[model samples]
Each structure stands twice: as C-alpha cells, then as structure tokens.
Target chain A: MALDADATLGEAGEFGLISQLVAQLGEALTDDEHVLVGPGDDAAVLRVKHGHVVVSTDLMVEGRHFRRDWASAEDVGHRAAAQNLSDINAMGGTARHLTIGLAAPADLPVQWALDFARGFAQECASVGATVVGGDTTRADEIVIAVTVLGECTVSPVLRSGARPGDVLALTGRQGWAAGGLAVLGRGFRSPRVLVEAYRRPEPPYAAGKEAAEAGATSLIDVSDGLLAEAAHLAEASGVAIDVRRDAFDVPEPLVAVGAALGADPMQFILGGGDDHALLATFPDTASVPAGWQVVGEVRDGEGVTVDGSEYDGPTGWTHF
Target chain B: MALDADATLGEAGEFGLISQLVAQLGEALTDDEHVLVGPGDDAAVLRVKHGHVVVSTDLMVEGRHFRRDWASAEDVGHRAAAQNLSDINAMGGTARHLTIGLAAPADLPVQWALDFARGFAQECASVGATVVGGDTTRADEIVIAVTVLGECTVSPVLRSGARPGDVLALTGRQGWAAGGLAVLGRGFRSPRVLVEAYRRPEPPYAAGKEAAEAGATSLIDVSDGLLAEAAHLAEASGVAIDVRRDAFDVPEPLVAVGAALGADPMQFILGGGDDHALLATFPDTASVPAGWQVVGEVRDGEGVTVDGSEYDGPTGWTHF
Candidate 1:
C-alpha cells in the first residue's frame, strides 16, 4: 500500500511495507558488479573485488541522536548512512554495500519509514553501494543501526599508525553540523544551510583514499570534534599534537552563522561533534592531497596544544 | 571494573562499559586469518577467502522477540547470533565474520551485557566466525542487531531454483523452539532441554554446504515455520510442495514436549517458527545428504499440501 501522509506503520503492516520499501531501494541502491543477491533472500550475496573488505556499524536513536522535532525522517536516514559510510571511507576504502536494522514504534507514520529508505538508499547509491538485506522490528523509539561494507583501495590507515613529526590535516568543514544544531535549537527554521549541515552531512570521502595513497600515517573521521579526535589520535599513536589555530584561519559558512546564533564559530569547531570530516596525519605535509588543509603537527608528548599553549576548551563528545 | 551482581550499565558509564565489554569479546571473537582489524577501529577489515561473500542481518527486540524474564542474557545473545548465522549457512556458505548492534536500557545490569556478549561470541565461534565490530547505544529496551558475512563453499542456492520432482528435505529438528516457548509461556521453567531449544538454537550449519555439494536445487532456513516456508518455496520455484507428515513420523523431543503441554505437537511443527532448521530440495530423494529427512516432494503447481490435501493451519509468522 502507498502510505498516506499520516498512515501509521501498523496500518501498513510489516511485510507489505518491507516489500514496498525494498523494491524501491533495490532499484536505486543496487550495483550489479558488487551485488550478487539482493532482498527477498535468505541472505544477500556480494562480490568483493578486493581480497579484503572494510566494515563498520553505527547506531542512531530517535531522541539521543536526532530529535524528531528537529530532523525529518529523510534527514535521519541520510545521517545514519553518512556516519557509517564515513567510517568505512576513513579506513581508505570505497563504499561497497550496506544493511540497516531499524526499529520504530507501531504508531509511527509509514510515510516516515518510506522517506527514510529513500534518503538512505540515495546516500548509499551516491557512494556506489548496494542495499543488501536488513531487519525491521517494533520499538518504543526509532532505532537505526547501519552497517557499511567497503573495498580497500590501498593499505588501510589506523589511528595507531601516526608517528612523531607527522602533520595533522583535515579535508572537510568542521563545526557546521553543531552550528546547525544551535540554529535548530533556537527555533529558527530559515537558516536552511546550517540546518541542512546538521541533518545531512557531506564528508570528504575521496580525500581519505587520496591521503591513504599518499601514505597517511593515521586517519579518522571527525565525528567527535577536532580536539577530542586529536586527543584520541594522540593517545592511540602515543604522540602529542600541536594545533595551529591560525591554520584554520579561513572565514566560511560557520563564521557566517556565528552571529545569528550568538555563539563563537571557533569554539564550535573545537568542541562540537558529528562533522564526519576526514582527519589524517601525514609524515610529509607536502604529500598531503589537494583538498586537505594543515591544522596541526604531531609531537613527542601526550595531549594536544593550541598555538604553543594548552587547549583547555571542550575537548570531545561522550554519551551518557 | 568488574560489574557487581546488580550494577547497572549507567553506573559503568558508556565509554567505560564499551571498553570493558569490547575487551572481553575481542579476546574471544577475533581470529587473525579471517580478521585484520577488530573492535578498536572505525571499521574492521576482514580477508574474504572466497571471491564472493554472503551477507544477512537479523535484529531482535526486547518485548517482541524475547522477554528477559523468559530468557537469560546469554540465551538472548546466542539466539540472535544463531538466527543471523543460520541465514548465511542456508545460502550454502561458511560463516566468516559478524557484526553486532546493541541497544540496552541504562538501568540494565552490566553483568547481563557481558554475559550477552560472551554467549554471542561463543555461538559465532562455533561456526568458525569472527566478530568484526559493532555499535552499542542506549535505549529503553535491549535490542540486538546481528549481521553475518559468510563465504560460499559451492555455488549459492536460491529459493527459486527448485524444479518438479525435487524432494524437499530438512536437517535438524523443527518446532522445538516453539515447544520451548510454550513451556516458558506456561510458567514451567523445568524441562531444561525444551527451554534450551527456545533460547539457543543449534542449526545444522554444515548441512547447508553439504546439500549444495550434493546438488540441491533450492534451500532456505525455516525461521518462519515449515508450512509457510513450503509455500514460499512453491511460489518461488513455481511449483507445489506436497508435505508428507508420515515422513517425519519418528519420535523426537518435540513430540515428547507436546505430551507435557497437552497441545497438538503437529501444530507447532507446521505453524510455529524460529527453528533455524535447514530446509532444502534435492533432485532425488536418494541423493539427499546424510542426516537430512525427506519431508515433501515438489510438483507442478502452487502452494503447499499436507498428505495431498490443502493445509488449513496458520499460514505464517508476521511481525507487527
């Protein structure tokens, strides 16, 4: 059944809704070269061109990850796919396929589920991924668990690989999602740019592969703010990082939105999470790819420093 | 820190709980040959020995799929993993790697979470599978989403490949889980075998590949009841399946449990679900693999028949 605007999921029924959504998603998300078996099977069959496969799973909760009042169903789907895809890409791999395990209240609108599949399918397709089989169940709140499978283009980079004297670099805008959240929290719906960033992230996927090919020592997606991620990299690699605040001197969309929210954009860049930007450390800064901008340098000690002093601002994100 | 008997997850904190549980599971679940990266990365990397991979995802919810009062934390984990692993096996593949997405109430005991991981880990190991990575989040009820990746031993079997005259066969017992559920529902905790059947299913994982090697025409795991699956096979293969109840005439645990409950065991066998038993069709009954019992025969028609007559029991299982 075609879901009306307000039709609840229970009214649509489980199998019928799955058939409708799967048929729609399968058409758009399938890559014949990568996918052997699609939905309506005991399991999905896929061809892994590379000998090794990269995989990641990320879960999003309705209230914890995204408030329904602040984000649309499409936004939730896209964000879920983006976060998982970004992690796979951060390992210097190309996105290949993905599956979703979704749970929502029976009273949820069926239209919301369809809209979710639409955005999720499109996002995976953008990364040349096929939608494999997944599970759906009933829940008190909407819980989306997405796992992405990716193919390696080069030797995978890990956080523990960074060495001393390596340059820390980033390839996408930071703090935009947090700024969008600020605007949304303030009840201003018109600052569509910030709100959009907060909803559907556009991570620099290709840059990760480029950095890996250029021999990046370590890499991570900036999902939990710059300083916080920097701290994780430092701890994992056993090296300190010196941040050059001047290197992030460019004035962009985040700076423009600062005045409207009455908040400092710089502070958001250093403290806010969910940007999903590609952050990496290169032994030679000159070898860093075109899109990546230098932000800091790996040092001998532990922890991170900003412009020759301690960065005591909000470090990273932690869920309770 | 070791969790006390009643220590809640929230008391352990998110990062701390993850660190402890992941440390525990990683020790038991990782194999160097199949897994390159384990729990501590953005995504885990695995070496797929087979050129192609078989993938399936299954999710279980608290109230709908299992109740904490009826099943222990370990049993829940094993059942969830068994469901996903069985799907991969049903495709004529060897289980290789798996990922989990877990959401639990903050007030849940940390010990319960650890036990769940332990059971989940052991079940995956039983099939020579390694745990890659997973996502853990907070929720009102415990939700487990398992995605299994398998390697094809022979050409994968499809549900639509059966032809007329193919003999339908099954490996492993049916209706045991339902029988177990019935026991649990009736508040009778004894009869450990019946309760165990409902909680931890032992699917004939090896038999799936064996059937394919012996030239089976079609295959599926009976997760949604035998009669329903028979109809599915018939519809998918464009043939009718005539089920022979007498073929399954031999006494087994299911029949033994029926007497205790004072219910028709045949109803559970035909209509009850969650057995994870391997059901397949071979071109010749004589060619059926060892341990497989012939249950029916395929013919030129649609739908399923019991002793050459239409079955009038419950058609199948559907999630709300």
Candidate 2:
C-alpha cells in the first residue's frame, strides 16, 4: 500500500494516515529519555535541557522549493529535513527532536506521503533526532513545514561574533545542488553523482560541533549561494569577508559537468545554492578542526568580496 | 510602506521581507532572558527549562481552514496562533515560543503580511510567548504552519488517562464558530457577535492550567465537533462518555439565531468545530475548577453517547 500510487490520502482517512506515520516514526525512535510523551497526543512532552534549545523551521513548497518531476517524494522529504538540520548545526547545537506539518491535496498519492514519512524518519534517525509530533491537512499543493529543536550544552555560536582577523572556512560541498539542477535543466541526467547530490544533500552535521568545540567565532549553513550567505555573515558581524576562490578546487565532476553544460565552475562554487555546507569563522586557521577548509579572512569593514573585490556574478537565490 | 497595498512580497524581495518581519517582531518583544538568540540567526536559541517542554504543530491552508474573504489577514494569523496555543494549553503546559512557516503567492500584499505579523506577535504576547523564528516562501495559495514550544513542570495530561467515574467538563464557548459560519454562509451580516467568533475565537487559555492543577485526568481541545472529540477521548481512554445535551443550556443569542434560521441549536452545540474549548475529565464535578462546567461522565464501556444514546446528528467534522 505504501508504494501504490492509486492509494490517495483521502481514501486513507486522517486517523489512518496518522497511524501509518506514527508507526513508521515510532519504530525509528529508541531513546525515550528526552521524550515524556510522543505522537498521538495533543502535544509532545520533551525533557528539555536547562540552558538552551536551538529551534528553527523551514518551508518547502511544491513548485517553489522543488519540482516533483525532478525529485522523488523521498528526496523531497530528505532535502527538507537536511536543510533544517543544517540550520541547527550552524547554531552549534545537536538536533534532538522535530515536528513536521504536512499539507497536501486529497488526491495526492498516499504512497508519496508514506515515502515522505519514511525519509523523514530515516533522516531523523541518521541525526539521532525523533519525530515527536506533527499535523496533517488537505490543501491545493503540498507544503512541508519542519521545526527542529536542538540541545546545546555549550554557548551557542552567534552570527554577530565574527571579528576582524578571523579566518573564514567552509566544510562539505558547495554548488553541487545547483550544478545538478543546471544539468537537469539542460536535459542531461548522465552525471548520476551530481544529480544524486542534488537529490540527497550530505550536510556536514558533525562539523558544527567540532567547530564550536575548537572555538568558532561565528557560523552559518550554506543553503543560499556562498556569496549571499557570506554577505549575511559580513552584515551580521559588522565586518567584511574576503574570499580567495583559489582556496577552493572545483570538484572534477562539477567542473566537467559545467564544461559540458557551458556553465562556469567558479559560479557554481560561489553562487549556486542548496549544498548544505558549514561556513565558519575561526581566529586562527592552524587550530581549525579537520574537514574545515579556510577560504577567506574577516576584516574591519562591511559586505563580502572575492580576492579583495566584489565579483560581478550571481549572488543568491530568491524564490519569487 | 507596510501599509501600501501595492507593496507586494515579491517586490520587497526575500531578505527585505524578512527584515521587515524581524523588525516588527523585535519591536513587539520586550524581554530577552529566555531567548538566547532570536530571529536573523540560523536558528533561535531559547533557554529551556529543566522540566518537560510540550510541543505542537498545526497547518492552516487557504480555502480549507480559512477563507480570506471571511477572515482578515490579521484574524487568520490570530486564529492560527490560537489553535496551536490551545493544543499546548490543553496539554497543561505554558507556551513559551512559536515558529511559523508561511507560504503565499508572490503577489500577496506586504500590508497583509504586516497585519499577520502584528496579530501573531500580539497573540503570542497575550500568552507570554514570543515569536522565535519562521520561514517564508512563495506558493500558489497561502499556508501558515505554526509550531509552538511549551514548558510543563507538572506531569502532562493525556487524553488516554481518563478512568471510569470521571466527570466530563468544558470551558469556553461551543458551537459559536460554527453558528457564525452558518450565518456567513447565508450571506447575512447582521449578527456581529456570532460572526466575530468565527473570525477570531477567544480560547480559554487560563482554564487549562486551572483544570490541570485541580487534577484533570484527561484533556483535549475541541478543534473538531464536541461529539467527535468526545468519541476520541472515549476511544483513547477505553471508557464510555455519556453526554447530556440538556445539561448544555444553549445561549440565548445562539438559540435565537438557530430559531431564526430554522437550525437546531443543540445540533450546533454537539457538532460544531473550531470553538477552541477546553474539554477535560476530572474525578468529580465538585473538584471541577473555575471557568469549567461539568457536562457528562466517563463510564465503564466504549464509544460516546448523547444522553446514553448514540448521537444521530452530525457526529464529527471531516475537513476533507
């Protein structure tokens, strides 16, 4: 039934649909130490830590965030969870719980929802978070709204903490998703690795804790283009960041794919989006943790630049 | 600029739109003791209490949960906040923070967004909860998904905790919202009070705590019809709930409206949704707290009965 496209959400009914979701999620969760009460209740009761809980939410709409034709339902669920988890990671917190609200048409395949639930549960398990609670309702289009709560024992990193003389660093892939999107847009699907990267992003989940422990001044998740997000960090910290493009060697696949698609590899590295990389600022690159690459430096100014000047390329993504 | 109808979300751009919303919310918030980090960060960092935190999420979609014509943008925002808050309150927890995910058409007026922010901030303030974080995106229709985090020092109440001989009690108005919908559906604008109930429900926020303190065994928020929710409590608790309709003396205004429209007031009281009433079960009616009225009893059996018989009227509401 979970794989049947003919099984619609309406035919499944509300309670029945919820039962399937709860069953799938309940199986993935093992630790109840933090959970006092879980799903099938008015609200979930979570045993919170005393100091701080990092909370963030993201909305992924059907057409605006992802195209159904380009990605599977499972991929949609995975991307949604990955993007939000990266947000918690950027805050130097470990995600422990999540609640997702799903809005989809009544005629939507129940199989899609089941696959979505599977991906949601699987992602949470991968990060050691649990799907504590959620809500579902009928709508014209599908919308997945995920809110994640994290436990941070140490002082959480702030975007405003970066200062002059700080080194800017990055971890994980950059521009891979957008590069994949470009390939798909050009009717090229042979680059399976690039397309798979777009389908299932690999965020540097553990790098955040490592950076925080090693004394990160500030951090951000690279969901938007690298240049755009760097601008955000610059503005928040009241400092200028200078990026050296030479610091990054474009991955061979992306470079080859860019050449075939007539796209610029540098632009993919700088201005492409949805590769959930961790960007951080450290006072000294020598002490920087593993998996983190120092790419730039923060100075006493505003805005972001590449090689001491602003690069005239695509800066960010705006859904509208 | 916020009041200008011509100023649309797309015209404002994503960063600009976020700045406007953040400024408005920051201005509304006066305290930051509980907020480790607010908006503009990757995620909000809240000072979590040592005890359990109650969490809930709900999704409201245009044309399904609300009609833009029937509800003002502000009203939609308020109701959305209210419904989710009520769920937390129903669990006997105090709401502390909320994150909303909004999906709307690119052409939606910025003024409408401003109005929604105002209402959301105001409502959160009313309950001592702050708007911690949110997401915004473009879609064909407007969808507001809210997630609330709450703290409960005492053990959280569950719908499955009711025992035989427990008394059923209710707080806040019932069927008023449905009655208002009935009036509006008929295109009648004369009844101001009933219509206002539909636009913005005044949930009994304080009653939940009082009931919990007084020892409510089971509790639920009446988002669905009274009969429908009663059935839920019965099944979950594995007990029979016998509701006496005669015990609920229909308010004169509702009775008059029902009479005028040739509709049964009792039916409205039994089968209406979205009144946000707190329904709970206590060991005895004598212990029912203030602002609560005992209307029925939990007995040894299964299913819900109206005056010891299955209700033949509208049993529940299925939005689908």
Model 1, position B98: C-alpha lDDT score: 88
Superposition error at B179 for model 2 (Å): 0.7
Candidate 1 interface RMSD to the true structure? 1.0
Flag regions of model 2 displaced more than 4 Å: A1-5, B1-5
lDDT, each prediction:
0.84, 0.87
Candidate 2, residues B1-320, lDDT tens digits: the string is 35344689888877778878887777645585788789999999888765678999999998888888887889887898899899988998888899988899989998888788888888888898899899999999999999999888677889999999999999999989888888888888546788899888889998787788899999999998898988889989999999988889798778877988998988778998788998999999888987788889999999999889888888667755
Leading candidate by DockQ: 2
For residues A1-320, could you state the per-residue lDDT of candidate 2 as single tens digits?
34344679888877778888788788755575788789988999888765578999999998778888888888988898898899999988899999989999999888888888888788778989899999899999999999999988778888888999999999999988888888878888858888888988999899888889899999999898898889989999999999999999989888898789777888988998798998999999786898888899999989999999879989878866
Report the TM-score for the A-chain of model 2. Answer: 0.96
